[model samples]
Target: MATWQCVKQCGACCHLDPAYRPDLDEYLSPEEMELYLSMVGEGGWCVNFDRTTRECRIYPYRPRFCRVEAEVFEDMYGICPEELNDFAIECCQEQIEGVYGDRSLEMLRFNQAVGYIYKEG
Candidate 1:
């Protein structure tokens, strides 16, 4: 499958959703952790993303997880800033299902899932 064309100069993904790693506190080495903590703001968006430039300050040494390739039919929810909330929920549910299977007791509510992790942090 061909990869999707990501919008260049768009910071949609940064605002789309946050990724949670139980090992976020463990996997990252000291320097990596410090860099991430310094770059990520309250909800994990790049701290230095200039809305005008739509760029990250630490793009070169961005976390390994941040280097995502756009996959075919990958279900983009962050193409437009306005749809970020809904897109985040869809992405989260997809991830939850992928990990815990389709039988998770956590009832999937699209709206409720949007920014859900933000509250936990």
Candidate 2:
């Protein structure tokens, strides 16, 4: 497996998904919070991200979630390739079920079984 540190110039994570966790609400300082909210209102990417520079604008006051280093799971299959594929599959399945009905339960169970093996190993 290859280990990598975010160059910060790459905004891949921000563009990968739109569902950001709200855990950051508590970590922002007053000024940082204001800036975050303002950026969010403008329909920009991550609140701390600089779209032009593709770097974190508020690195000093970044939330814990953002500060977390890319982990083993993240690097697994080389820079989270497998995990990203799994995430995409899960998202598609969820959307399909939402539009239709709960049809992916067996697939979900299979994924859970695989996840348990991965976790235990």
Candidate 3:
């Protein structure tokens, strides 16, 4: 089975465009919503994301909404621990595909890291 793992230098999740996530209020609390919006910078990328480095500047202290922990996923999306792997993988797949093309290098790296095998259709 495939496991979910974040790929290095793949900051696709940092593309925090509110336009694509219209249901932000549904999942995040009021404070989180505000913080989430505040993090959105030019081109909808996270303000803390260093484009050149492809890394989060505030990674160590990033908001709860930015974490991929089981508890955080449970609270935000009602995802149980046993389901976290697939759920996180799916979320990453969609986000990465949206931020970058499905065939982009980021997607390739993410799939390999997660042990996800796919074929072009």
Candidate 4:
């Protein structure tokens, strides 16, 4: 079975483009929405993301929305703990592909880290 794991140096999730996530109001509370919007920087990337290092500047203290924990996923997206692994993998795959391309190094690294073998078409 495939499991979900974050690959180091892959900041694809840092591409916090609100335009890409139109349902922000649906999942996030008003305060969280405000904070989320505040974190967005130029080109929709997260202000806390370090482009030079490709990592989150405030990783240890990142908001609940930025975490991938099963409980957090359940609260945010109604994804059960049993389903978290697969769900997270799919989410990461789509987000990584959206932020970087499907063929991008970030996607490759994420897939590899998760033991996913995506075929190029």
Best by TM-score: 3
Task: List runs of model 2 lying over 4 Å from the truth.
Answer: 16-44, 70-121
- Per-residue lDDT tens digits for candidate 3, residues 23-78, read 99999999999999999999999999999999999999999999999999999999
Pairs of residues clashing in candidate 1: none
- What is the clash count of model 1? 0
What local lDDT does model 3 show for residue 40? 94
> Candidate 3: worst 10 consecutive residues by lDDT?
111-120
Instruction: Flag regions of model 4 displaced more than 4 Å.
Output: 119-121
Any runs in candidate 3 off by more than 4 Å, and if so which?
119-121
- By TM-score, the better pick of 2 and 4 is 4
Tens digit per residue, CA lDDT, model 4, 31-113 = 99999999999999999999998889999999999999989999999999999999999999999989889889988888888
Candidate 1, which segments miss by more than 4 Å at Cα?
A: 4-6, 13-23, 58-121
C-alpha RMSD for every candidate: 12.6, 11.6, 1.3, 1.5
Q: Which of 1 and 3 is the better model by TM-score?
A: 3
lDDT of 4 at 69: 98
Worst 10 residues of 2 by lDDT: 1-10
Could you give candidate 1's per-residue lDDT for residues 1-121 as a string of tens digits? 1112333454544542226544555445677567666666745556766656767666776566455433311332124644443444555455555443544543233223332432333
Per-residue alpha-carbon lDDT of candidate 2 for residues 1-121, written as tens digits (9 for 90 to 100):
2222333354434432224435434555567566555555234356666778867777786643344333533532233654554554454344334433444553344344434222343
TM-score list, all predictions: 0.38, 0.36, 0.96, 0.95
33 in model 1: Cα distance from truth in Å? 1.4
In candidate 4, position 79 carries an lDDT of 94
